[model samples]
Target: MAAVPMDDPGRTPSSYWAATAAAGPDIPPFDGSERADIAVIGAGYTGLSAALYLAERGFSVLVLDANEPGWGASGRNNGQVVAALKHEPHEIEERFGKERGGELIRTIGEGPDLVFGLIERYGMPCDARRSGILTAAHSAASLADLQRRVDVWARRGAPLRLMSRSELESQSGTAFYPGGCIDPRGGAINPLGYARGLAAAVLQQGGHIRRQAHVRSIRRAASGWQVMLDSGSVMASRVIVGTNGYTDDLWPGLKRTFLPARTPQIVSRPLRDNLRKSILPVGQIMSDTRYLTVGVRMHADGRLHLGGGGGTAGADRPALYEQLPREARRLFPQLGDIEWEFRWSGFMAMTPDRYPRLFELAPDIAASLGYSGRGICTATIMGRELARWAAGEAAIDELVLPASSFRTLPYYALRGPIVEGTVLFHSLRGRLKTPG
Candidate 1:
C-alpha cells in the first residue's frame, strides 16, 4: 500500500460518523494480479457509488482504498445534503455557456432526490432527514445576495421560500439572522453511515471493495490500463480516480488543481429536551452567509453538531476547538457552559472557480474531484454519471457534466499561504458587516 500519511490533530483519524456507522465488511487488500472491467481508486462515496452502479449493470468492478471506506472527507463532512453549488447561476452560465449551463443546473438540482432515493432503495438505516436546509444571512449584504439566489431558483420552479427575520426566529432558535432562504428539496444525513451503506450496496451487487489497497500509479497499457498497488497490480479496461482532497501523486499533478482546506467540527453532549426543541425547532439543517461558513444541525440523538473554522491546510491550530464553542455560545447564548463531546477535522477540495470538474486524463482513465465542499449530493450523482460513461452507455460529451482539461495553479506550492490569506480577508469582511 502507498505509505499512509502520519496522523495529525488537524487530520482527524476518527470522527463521530465512524463511531456511529454500522460495522462494514472487512474486505482484505489486493495481494496479486486481478482482472476487471473497471478499476476504481478511493472507496469514498464517489468510488463506491460508481462501483455499485457499474456492478449492478453486470460489469466486473474492483474498488481499492488506502483505508476503510468513508475514512476520508466523505465520512468527515458536515453532513448537509444541499442541492446548490457555490457557483452563482450567472457564473455557471458564463463559464459553461447558457445551453450546457442549463443542463448543469438541472443535474445539480436533482442531487438531493438522487441521494435520498439511493438511501430508500437500499433501505439504509442512515439517519436521513429531508426536512429542508436553511441558509441564514449573517449580514444585510449577504441577505440581499441570498434573496437574489432565491429569485433565481424560484423562477426555476424550485420549492424555495424567503423567510423574514420574524419567521426565522423560531426556525433558527436565534434572532441573529435577519433573513434568508430555505430550499425544501435539500436535507441532511449521517454521512459516515451513508458511506458505509454505499459500501454494503456495492458488495451486495457483486462488486469487490479492498481496503488498505493503496494505488501507487496508473499507466496506459496495450490491453487498456494498469493500476499499480502496493503489493500487486491490477489490469483493467477502465480506471476511475475519485480520491478528492486525499488525492496524491498517483495521477501526476492532479493534487495541484485545487487546495485541500481543513475544516474542524465540534459536537456537543446531547442537549436537554427543552433545549433541543428550542434549537432548530423544525430539525432543519442550517448554515450562514459568513465567508468562514458554519453548518449546524441536530443529530437524531439530540446532540448538537457544528462544523466550521476553515484553516491552513492541516496545520495544527490549537484554538480551533476553543473558537467553535465560543462562536456556538454567541449564536445560542441561552445554552451556557455547553460541554463539547467530540472534535475532529476533514479536508475539502476547493477549486478557484468553486465548481466540480471531471477530467478524462487518458483515453481510458478518468477523474472527478474538486467538489468545493458540496460533495455529498454532487459526488453521488457524479458517480452515477461516471458509471454510465465508463460502461459506454453514454458518450463523454453526452454526460451531464462535460470533461475539462486539467489545469494546475502556477507555483502551486504557495497555495497554502494564498488560501489562508484569502480566508482571513473574508472572515474580517464578514465580521465587519455583521452586528456584534
Candidate 2:
C-alpha cells in the first residue's frame, strides 16, 4: 500500500461525510500483478465514474486509489452541484466562442441532472435532491451583477428565480444579503455517497477496484504503458492521471501547470427539528458573492455546512477560520448561537485559464486533470468526454469544449505568499472603506 498522507486541518479530515459513510468495503491491496484494457489512478468522482462508464462499454478496467474511494475531496466537498461555471454567460461566449461555449454551458447546465440521474439509476441512497442553489449577494453591486447572470441563464431556459431583499432575508434567515438569484436547475447531494456509489456501480459492471494501490510512476511499455506501484505493477493499454490537486512530483511539470489552493469547510451540530424545518424551508443550497466565496447548505442530517477559506496545512486553518464567522453569522443568524462540531479542508487544482485541463502526455498516454474546484460534476463530465475520446468516438478537436495545451504560472513558487498577501490586502481595504 502506498503511504497515506496524514490528514491536515486544511484537508477536511474529520468530515461529516466520513462520519456517516455506510461501512466502506475492505477491498484488498494491490499486492500482485494486474493487467487491463484501462487503468485509472484515482477513485474519486472522475476516476470512479470513468471506471463505471468504461466497464459499461465492456472494457476490462482497474481503478487504484491510495486511500479508500471517495475519501479525498469527493467525500468532503460542499456538495453544491451548481449549473454554470463561476463565469457569466457572455463571458463564456467571449472566451470560448458562441457555439462551443453555448454547448459547454448547456452540457454542464444539466450538471445536476447527470448527478441525480446516476443516483436514481443505481438506486443509491445518497440524500440526492433537486433543491435549487441560491447565490446570495451581500452588496448592491453584487446583486446587480447577479441580475445580469439571471438574465443570461433565463435566456438559455435555465429556470432561475430572482429574489428580492425581503425574499433573501426570509430564506437566508439573515438580512446581510441585499439579494441574490436562484438557479432552479442546480441542486445538492451527498457527495461521498455519489463517489462511493459510482465505485460500487463500476464493480457491479465487472470492473476491478483496488484501494491502497498507488501508482508511483508511469513509463512507456512496448505496446502500452506500465505503472509502477509501491508493491507491484500494472500494465495497461491506457492510463489516466485523475489525481488533480493531489498530484505530486510523480510526474514533473504537471503540478506546476496547476495551482493547488486549499479550501476548508465546517459543519454545525445538527439543528433541531424546528430550526431545520425553518432554515431551509425551500431546500436550496446557497453560496455568497464575495471574492472569497462562502458556500453553505443543510445536510440530510439537519446540520449546516459552512464552506470556504484558503491557505495550506497546519498554519492555515486557524487563520482561515477567523475569516469565516462574520459571513456565516450574517447568512444565518441562527448559526451565531451554534458552535461548529466539525471542521476540515482540502486542496483543489486550478489552472491559469480557469477551465478544466485535458491533454495527451504522449502517444497512447493521456491525462485529464485540474478541474479547478468544480471536480464533482465537471470531472465526471470530463470522464465521459474522455471515454469517448479514448474509444475514438471523437477526435480531441471534436471535443464538446475547446481543447488546449497546459501553461504555468510565472510566479508558481510564490502562490502561498500571493494568497496571504491578497487576503491581507482585501481585509485592509475593507477596513479603510469602513473606517473601523
lDDT of 2 by residue, 1-436 (tens): 1111223332325678777755455567788879998888888887887788888999988998877688677887788888777678888889889999999989888877887888899877677788788888757777888999888888987788789978976776656667888887778877877887888888889988998786788888886989888888999998877777777655667767776767778888888888777666777888876655678787777887778744442233466665566656655566547778887767677676668877777665666777766777788877777777666677777776677675666777776766566556755544343211
Residue pairs of candidate 2 with colliding backbone atoms: 11-345, 12-344, 12-345
Off by over 4 Å in 2: 1-12, 313-316, 425-436
What CA RMSD would candidate 1 show? 2.5
TM-scores, one per candidate: 0.95, 0.92
Worst lDDT window (10 residues) for model 1? 1-10
Candidate 1 Cα outliers beyond 4 Å, as residue runs: 1-12
How many steric overlaps are in each model, in order? 0, 3
lDDT accuracy of residue 223 in candidate 1:
94
- Residue 152, model 1: lDDT of 86
TM-score of 2: 0.92
In candidate 1, what are the lDDT values of residues 270-343, reduced to their tens digit? 99988888889898999988868789888878888899755556454576466678778888888888788888
